[model samples]
Target: MSVTMSPGRYRGLRNVSLPAADTFGIVAFDQRGSYRKMMGAQASYAQLCQVKSEIISALSQSASAVLTDPIYGMDAAMRMSPRAGLLLALEKSGYSGDSSYRKTELIPSWTAQTICQVGADAVKFMVYYHPESGVLAEELEALIKQVVARCHACDLPVFLEPMSYSLDAAVPKASAEFAAARPAIVIETARRLSRIGADVLKLEAPHDIAHNQDEAAWQASCEQVSAASAVPWVLLSAGVDFAQFERQLRVACAAGASGFLAGRAIWKEAATMSSAARANFMAEVAARRLDALLEIAARDARPWSDFYTLPQFDATWYEAYALC
Candidate 1:
């Protein structure tokens, strides 16, 4: 594919967000509801921030960027000084509606200007989606377009994450029927959302994890997702185990994924350990996972530059650039 080098502001910020040149090894610490569910009664504000800060501190140095929530990790990320660039989550903690038709909402009183002013390199908004949701799908797509316009206006890249859920109440995600159809759902979701103009995509595994164990199927599904996405794309861990996620990452990278913006598979186990052990795990085990992921990504993953090359310009180029 040919690359387009556009205005330098957006290009530069996008490059900063991907520390590994054009590849992504973003560490997603922005999770809320699931983070609480895992910790149960212990999911206090203090505990959440602590976990986010600690593990992020341990892992951020290796990641391309850190995806943080406004309420918790953003402050710590700005203060503690991680080596990675920051990508703030614009969506609220969880989605509206049930398993049938989920809708995502932005965090109250937050805007693209807030993200740019806070020195974030990118904005991430995740919507639980299925193109078949009709008006609900339109609503989510509208929100994404609004976010993309705003972020691009601010010269910040937006990483759109479109999560697929079973719309049929009868055929839940755990059912065999749902698993069989998940690949198509994810690919179509990518195809639909790609047209919204987000700079990067952080997507879930296209193939079903529990029901499908075939490596060939995994590779084919990932290739389809890559082909469907017009922009660059990365893999998300999606609460899978480390070993399984590693396998998925390998398949995805080889099939044309830029890299990963993973969370649970890399650090969830640390949350369940004791405080001291948590610190140890973050420094040792989780840190090693980051290394492993980075190595895989650097080796087999496609670069975001594959989609758009960074702008080349002279020092005086800024004089002509608009900053509204």
Candidate 2:
């Protein structure tokens, strides 16, 4: 399917400023509560920032872009690696808390304009979505439209990540029932959000945790997601184990995924290791793992830019943009 967006937005998407714009093998470190949970109870903000920096330093050379959050590690990440392409996460965490159930909001300090000023290549928003949640779905669509308009005015590309979670009172979040329902829920949510005009879609692989190893089921899920997506879509690791994520990526790419924008599977261990060991671990362990994924993507992934016929650059066009 062809990408449907304005010419400016197309340029913005192409200008990812990565080693390869066609294929996005991005390393994401934009976790909050999840990172802390993966580490231990004592994981501090400072430690998170340090580990994020180490991951960027180690893997940025192999990765096309890096996704970082505004609060903890973005500044240090930007300062530490000027050449690496960066995408800033705009949303605040804790939306799932009982007090704030289904309320997704942007971080107070950073807006689309402000994020662009920080030299970000693009901006990303991760929304937890469930088709059954009527009011919440409407609220999220409104929020996405506002952000897309803001980003259009600023001429920045926006990536929308729609993740599924159960909202039914009777179905436990981790139960077999929730797992059984997630693949369809995820595909439908992607179709819904793709119509809202995001430049890119960062999706969770449709296979549930239990069915991840089922190749036939995964291929079916991938085909459904690829058919539903209007824009270029990439798969997120979703904290799955490295081998599982690697298999998921292969299946996704073969079934028409652009590539991957993975986080935890690439750098989860960095959070748990001591500061002294973090750098070495990132360089040796994390970098190698990322390289393996990149190899897989290069072998099987489709190029996002190839989906459209981009206009040839001429002297007049360069003059129009004041590039001369």
Candidate 3:
């Protein structure tokens, strides 16, 4: 089966010289609590140092450009290294329950300014879970166009990560139930986003692993996503183990996904290491994983590997190094 996507929406980063069919990229970062969360840079600040090192090391070794988030916020994170090419993970304006703050906050303004600050080297500006906030598509489109206009005014690139499925904002919801229902809903949602001027789309893989929820069902959903999306498709890492993760990667690639925007998996390993050592470790594993995924992206057939042949990287490594 052949899958396809629209390529006209990508911006900011330098174009991959590789053909669209052959090009697949990796992006790794932490968004929870990195150096950005802590104010003072103390010797005892082992946590910040470790995460930063892992990110730096990963950026240096891999051909894939790393997209860094403030983890907490840019001002705090940048105290360590402000010059890195970063994707300002712009928080949606109204979600914080402070409409007044949205107007005055650093996110909308600083994101635009930073794009200009970076100029031609514009790092991507990504917004997570925009549609699910109960914002109308027309309203969402206006906000996106506003951001895009701001980016254009500053000559920066904009990358919008839209989900193929919608989720209820009400808390205390059942995650497993949501996971089970997400696949079917995403197909139409993907189509809706394509029409709304989204520059890029990031979607979750299907959760059903049994015959009733087999890989083929997910592949079908991927086909739907690719067909409906007017922009490029990048699958998200759903925090599965290496075997399951690789399977998802293959499904995405076979369905014509451009690449992925991955987090936790890369940084989880360095959470416990010293700042410098963590960076070096993440760089190596990220490089290995990048090569492996790219190999999957370039293939015409899905090659199921023997689990024994796969490298031994576990959840502990992720907690310590993969996530922020």
Candidate 2 backbone collisions, by pair = none
Candidate models: Cα lDDT each: 0.82, 0.77, 0.49
TM-score for candidate 1, residues paired by index: 0.93
Across 1-324, the per-residue lDDT of candidate 2 in tens digits comes to 564444555665555534454777888888876766776777677776777677677777777778888777675566555555778898986585453246677888788888777777788998877777888789889989998888767767899988777787677656788888878888898788988968789998887765456898999988898888777789999888898888899899998888899988988877777777887888888888999888877777878776655656756764544110
Model 1 misplaced regions, further than 4 Å: 1-21, 79-81, 312-320
| Per-residue C-alpha lDDT of model 3 across residues 241-296, encoded as one tens digit per residue | 55566777788778867666565554455555666676576566655766676566
Candidate number with greatest TM-score: 1
Cα-based TM-score, every candidate? 0.93, 0.89, 0.67
Predicted structure 2: lDDT: 0.77
Best by lDDT: 1
Worst 10 residues of 2 by lDDT: 315-324
For each candidate, C-alpha RMSD in Å?
2.0, 3.1, 12.2
Ranking of all candidate structures by their TM-score, best first: 1, 2, 3
